[model samples]
Target: ASRTETVKSVYDKMLNSIKEKKTAPPNAWLWDFIAKCSSKEDIELLFDMLQKLRIFRLSSLRIHENFNTALCREVTKACVRVGAIEYGKKAALWRHNAFGLTPDIGSTHHLLLYSKQLNDVNLLVEVMKLVKKNELTIQAGSADIVFSICSGADRWDLMTKYGKRFVLSGIKLRQSSFDMWMEFAAKKG
Candidate 1:
């Protein structure tokens, strides 16, 4: 079947199941298949399918079941690959808000990963705004991503600004990310 037809078929099935309130397992292998699509358009089409079918929730349920964190990461990566930054950001947020599992540290870092991969300063800055508003805690990989973002942009002003927030919260960077903090510190000095 053509890619378009396949996407439409999968989308229709998913919506039908939702309408029927069926408890059947997800296509069970759909994302794995979607991730393997070679063309960017094909990948974007799959992302569209995901959005249309509410597949992000299905994937989130799998993550909740401890199926695999890698699948969560792969979906985020695929969303990024297809330039679905906003959707990818929303997916990352859902994984945290819905499942309570920090698939890359509570979506903040996952969104940071997407921003870094996309080299989207605007998105990064938006995340910074969120950090400011919520006073969110940065942990593990999320901390690393935020630190890398700060250092990559040479935004010591922003780093020093947010660094105070990190220090004040008593959340230390991971050992692996010490270098990034050091870079930030060095630049600030």
Candidate 2:
């Protein structure tokens, strides 16, 4: 398990599998494993092994049944954690644009929240661009955080825009988002 293992042991085992040319595991299992693992250092090692195995994808990791959105989301989160925001956003875009499939909502939320927490406005804008490109409604996790930020910053325009996005997104605004919006309104008049 990732919990008990040192990075060296995990990397070595994965590398050995690559050396032996073991068949690639199912994409689902692979992504699930990545989600469970801690540390970007270990994740980078896993990705290197994947790359060496010749399965490193720029985007759109298709499986036997369908497009792999869950994996895309997990990968994006990992990328953000490691401060690889642009790379993560581009890969997500590539996944949708190149493959003609929408990004999964979970990933969308995760990417937005992570970017906001990082205080990366550029990455947040890029993620928003991707959302429009893919025709996705903003998911709640992302919407709430953005609202809070805009409110705190007194960026009335941004607050309004995010409010519209939240409404159009049709995801219920969380209490924090609602509370922030009210605070913004109270301060305005």
Candidate 3:
């Protein structure tokens, strides 16, 4: 079957399950498949389906913590792949609001990664603001991405700001993160 057909089939089945009040949630694999298949055109469809699942209180969805984070990360990746960075931001906020999902580090990392790839300091700042608003923990990997973003953009101020935050938050800096921070500080001095 074609990708569209498969997506449509799964979409229909999920919708029917919600309508019929199925006690069991769909398998994690199904959600993973949807996330992997998400694209610019069909991203709204994916978001709508997720909203519906939450609205109907489908099978204690929040219980699947691992799946939820993976889904968010994959969806963010799909959005980045298609250059739909705004949609990705909206999706992250939407998941936080609608499903009570915390923005995971992986999702934040992916957005930051793309911000670096695009060399857009404004986008990097926006993603960081979202992270701050959501109070998501800054992990070592994400710190590396932020440091890289600041380094690439020649934004020493941003590097200092977030570097201090990471230090105060007690997040362990990876060796690469340390290297970038020190290199930038030395250059600034």
Which predicted model would earn the best TM-score?
3
lDDT of each: 0.59, 0.61, 0.74
TM-score of 3: 0.80
lDDT score at residue 20, model 2, on the 0-100 scale:
63
Mark the 10 consecutive residues where model 3 has the least summed lDDT: 58-67
Q: Encode model 1's per-residue lDDT on 101-148: one tens digit a residue.
A: 224445456678777776666788787676555545566566667667
RMSD of each: 5.4, 5.2, 3.2
Sort the candidates on lDDT, descending order.
3, 2, 1
Candidates 2 and 3 compared: the better one by TM-score is: 3
TM-score of 1: 0.63
Worst 10 residues of 1 by lDDT: 95-104
Instruction: Please state the error at residue 155 of candidate 1 in Å.
Output: 0.6
Question: Which parts of model 1 have CA positions greater than 4 angstroms off?
Answer: 1-4, 20-74, 94-106, 131-137
1-189 per-residue lDDT for model 3 (tens digits): 866566666777778877776644466635654555545556666667666666666455444432367667777777787677876786554334664344577777788888888899999889888888877878889889899999988999999999998999999899999999999989888
Give lDDT: candidate 2, residue 67: 44
> By TM-score, is 1 or 2 better?
2
